[model samples]
Target: MTGDFRYRLERGGVKYACPACRQQRRFVRYVDTLTGEQVADEVGRCDREDSCGYHLRPSEYFRQTGTKPPTAAARRKEPMPEPEPSSIDAETAGRSLTGYGHNNFALWLCSVFGEEIAFRLVDAYHVGTSRHWPGASIFWQQDVTGKIRGGKIMLYDAVTGRRVKEPFNHVTWVHKALKIELYHLRQCLFGEHLLAADPVKPVAVVESEKTAIVAAGFMPEYIWTATAGKGNLKVVKLGLLRGREVTLFPDLGAFEKWKAAVDQMPGVRVSDVLERRASEEDRVAGLDLADFILREQAINV
Candidate 1:
C-alpha cells in the first residue's frame, strides 16, 4: 500500500510540523459529521521542513498514513470502537482500557489503568517489536516531542491462538515462563495499575517497561502509560476518559509534576499509598486497587 496520502489543508492554521521533514503545512477545517465540531488541523507532518526551507505545516502527515479523502456520506458512516461492556453486578468496569492487538502485558495494563493510558501505549508501541520483547509487538505512546509515555509486554495464547485477554492470562504465562509465583505477577500488574490510578499521578515518565513495572508498586492507577520518548504525548489518549472520573497515579520518581498534571484534569481525585501498612512480605508495596483488595483480606485476617 502507498504510504503517502493527501489532504486539502487551510493556508496557515495548524500546530505540529512533520516528523520526517518538519514543515508547517496549512490547515483544512472540515465539519465533523459526528461531533459537528469543525475539525481543524488534520493529523500530519511536514515533508519539506528539513531539506527545504519551507515548513509543510499540519494536516499533511495525517494524510501521509494513506487514508482516502472521505466524501460527505462516508465521513458520516465512519464508526468508532464501542466501549467495553460494563456490568453493574460485576461492581467494577471490565478494565476501561481495551487491549491493542496482542500483548499480554498490554492487556494487563488496561486492567490496571483506565482506557486513556492504554491508547497512549498503543500509539507508541504499534511500530512492532524491539529489544525488550523480540517478535512481540508492543503498544505504547509518545508525545509530539517524542518522549516515551508508557507501554507494556504482550504474548499469544497457545490453545486459543488468540491474544491473551486479561491480567490473569499474563500472570499465568509469566508463571510458566519464569516459574514465578502468582504473588510476583500480582505485584507487578497491581503495582502498575496503582501507578496508573489514584491521587496525584506522577510524571517523571521514563521508557523502560520493566522499570515501569517496578515503579508501578509506588502508585496505584496513576497515569503511567509508556511512550518512546518526550514529544510524543499526542499518542496519549486522555480523550478516552471523556466522561469518566480519573485520578493521578505517579511513578516513584516524578511524583510532584505528576500530581500537578492530575490536579489540572477537570474531575480527578487523589489518595496516598501507605507503604508502611503492609503485614505480608508480598503485600503490594503501595496502596492501589490491588492493595485495596489486599487490605480487605487483611481486615478479615
Candidate 2:
C-alpha cells in the first residue's frame, strides 16, 4: 500500500516466452519506483491462472525474506491536485523560437549536425531559446492534441551540447517562472506531438529530450520521444502507447530498472543493446543512447 508501490499491466499484456509454460505474454512484476528496484526476482506472475500460475507478490516476498512491509500510513494515497487551465499559451512558446543564436543547445547541435540538420531538428521539436540565462534553451512539451503542456528551460554548454548543471542547476519551468498562480501543470511526454503525426511508426522512448532529438535525427524510422526523467515513466503517460509498439532505451545503470517497470506494460520492450555492448566503465559513467550515437558519428567522421 506504499504510495511508491503501484501495480500496472506488464507489457500491455503482450505475451512473452514464459519461463514456466514456455508460452507468450503473461508476466507482471512489482516495482519500487522510489528506489528504481524490482521487489523480488521471482515476483513476476503469469496471467494463465491455471496452467502457468507463477505469481509472487511483494508482500509474500517480504514475509519470506523476514522484512517488514511498509506501514499503512506510508501506503495512504495523497490527493492529487486537479489540473487547472494552463497559462502557458502557444504565443509564449513561439516567442522562444525567435532567436536561435542565443540558444546554446541549438548552436551546439548546429555545430555537430550542421545548420540544415540542426535547424530541421529545431523546427521539428520546436526547440527554443530563453533569456532566463544567456544561451539557455527551452524544450516545449506539446501533447498529441496540439496543447502546450509546459516548457522546460535549461542551460547548456554550447561547445559540448551537455547540460550546464553546475552553479545551482540551471533548470526551471515556464509556469513557475511566470508566477502563474493556480496554473495546474499537466506534463505530457516530450515530442509527444509526433505520435499523432505518424500513427504507424513505432515509438522509441528515451530518458532525455536531447537524446530523443539526436536519435530521431540519426534514425528516422521510429517516432522518438522522451519521458524527460528516469522516474517520470508513469503509467498514465504511457497510456498513449497502449496500442503501439514501444521500445525503451534507458541510460547505463537503468536497464534493469526500466526492464522491471516496462515488464508490466504490454507492447513495450526495453533494449539490452547497451547492456550487452557497454563496458563496465561506460556503465559507471552512465552513458546514454546519445553518447553511443555521438561516439559512432565521431568514428565515422
Candidate 3:
C-alpha cells in the first residue's frame, strides 16, 4: 500500500456531529485528498478535546474499518517539526509607545471619544505611533502571556479614522521593517494580551484593530479584540480562547465565513447585527460593526 494518503482536516471550520457525544459543530471531519470527500463518518477529532476525547485519524480508521485507501504516487515523507515563531523584544515595544501626538489614528480616536477617554484606551492597549508613514499607527499584537507577537503598521486619515488606502494601502509589519531574517509570523488576536487583565471578561472580536479600539470605548463591559484581518483567522490560535465567552463580529460580506469559524470554537457566538441591519449600500461598502456603533453614538466621523 502506497502511503500517499494526503488526508487533512477540511477547511472553512466545517464541523459535524461528534460520533462520541452526538453533539453538533464539535467534530472535525477528515477528508481524503484524491476523492475530494470525507474518509468516514466516524473519522475525525472532537473539539471538546478535554471533556470528550474522540479522535480517529484516517490511517487508524482504515486499519480498524478493514478498508484500504486508494494508492496514489510516492510515499509520504515524515513531516518536519515547525520552528517556533519569533517574538519582538519588550524594549522595542516600549520604544514604540511614543509619538502618539502626531499619530493620525490617535487623533481620530480623540475626536470620537474626547481626549481623556481616548488616551485612556490607547494607554490600556499599549498602542504606538510609527514613523513608517506620515501619521501612521502601530497596533502591536501581544499574546496572553504578554509577549510581543508582532506590530501592524498602517497609515490612517486623521479626520475620518479610515485607513489610507488610496496611496497603495500603506501597511507593513514591524518585523519586516526591521529586516529581521527568516521571521516566522504566528499571530494571535490584536488585543489578546488584555485578557490577562480580566480573565472572566467576555471578549468582543472584530475584523480590524481600529474597530476593536472603537468598540472598547462604547462598551466597556466586553474586552474588545481584533483578529487583525479576516484571513488571519486560524482555528488553533483561536482555540486558545476556548474557555472564554467570545463573540465574533465579521464584516458585512463575511458573515458565513466567520460563522463557520465560530462553529469550530465551541462556545463562541457570531453576531448578526450587521447582517440584520445593513442596507444593500452598506453591504456593497463592506462596513464593520464600528461604523454602525459610531453612528448609534452620534459621533460625527
Candidate 4:
C-alpha cells in the first residue's frame, strides 16, 4: 500500500457506536475517501478518551479485513468539518436555578455553612434541585462559553452529607430525563464556569461534585472544579485548564492512575494531599478531599 492515507475521519454529527466501548454516537468512523462511505462501522475512534481509548485506523481495518487498499491514484475528497457540541437551552437551565430549597445537597450545605454561604456556593456552581428524587440535586456542568453541557443529578442525605445508595445508587443525567433525543453530552469539569470568573486564582480539581462545592466553601482562594467522577479525568475536559496552574486531587486509591493520565499535559499537577494524609481505614472507605475538609471542620467546632 502506498503511503497516501486512503480515508479520513468522517466529520459532521453522524457518529456511530464505538466498536470497543459500544457507546452510541461516540465513535468517529473512518470514511472511504474515494466512495464517501465508511470503511466499516467498527473502524473508528471512540470519543471517551479517558475511559475508552479505542482507535482503529483505516489501514489497520483493511489489513484485518483482508481487503485491498485504495491505490495512491484514487482521488480523495476532504472530510467535512465537525459540528459544534450540543448545549442545553439557556431558558431550560435558567428554570433549574429555583427549588434549591428542596435540594438535599444544598440543604446539607446550608446546614454546614448556613444559608448565606450555602446559596453563594450553589449559585457559583449552578447547582439545581431535581424532582426526580425527593431530595436530589443537579450539578450542572457549565463551560467557559456560558453553555450548559449537561447536569449530573444525584441524591444525598441532608444530615449525613453522603450519597444515598439504599434504594440503589441514586444518580442520573438531566439530558436523559428530559428525553432529548440524540443529545450529545460533552462533559466539562463541574464548576468550570468559575475559571472565567476567577481567572488569576489557581485551580484545584477533585473527583466529586460535592467535594468541589464543600472545598470551595473552606478554601475560597482556589477556583475549585470537579472531574465529576474518577473516570472523567480526560484530556479534552481539562483542555481549558491550559496556561493556568492546575492541581488535581484524586480520590483515595486513585492517585497513581490520575497522576499517570495528567502527566502528559504541561502546567498540570496532581496533588497527593489525600494520599499523604489518609490512614488505611480512610483509604478503604475511599475518602476524598471533601472528607478531610469536613472532618477538620467538625473537629475544630
Candidate 1 segments whose C-alpha is farther than 4 A from its true place: 1-137, 140-238, 274-301
lDDT of 4 by residue, 1-301 (tens): 2422767888888888888888988999888777777878788889899999999887787788888665545544556555676788878887888887788899999999999999999998899888989989988988887988898889999898999998699999998889888888878888888888766788888888899889889888788888887888872345687777888888878989998898788888888777788899987887667889898752111
lDDT of 2: 0.78
Q: Over the stretch 69-187, how does candidate 2's per-residue lDDT look in tens digits? A: 55556544666557664737888789888789888999999988899999998899988888888999999999888999899999989998888988789999878888878777777
What's the CA error at residue 174 for candidate 4, in Å?
Answer: 0.9
All candidates in order of lDDT, best leading = 3, 4, 2, 1
Instruction: Name model 3 segments beyond 4 Å from true.
Output: 1-76, 235-239, 298-301
Kindly give the stretch of ten consecutive residues in candidate 4 with the minimal lDDT sum: 72-81
- Select the stronger candidate by TM-score from 1 and 4: 4
lDDT of 3 by residue, 93-115 (tens): 88989888889998999999999
Off by over 4 Å in 4: 1-83, 235-239, 297-301
lDDT of each: 0.37, 0.78, 0.83, 0.83
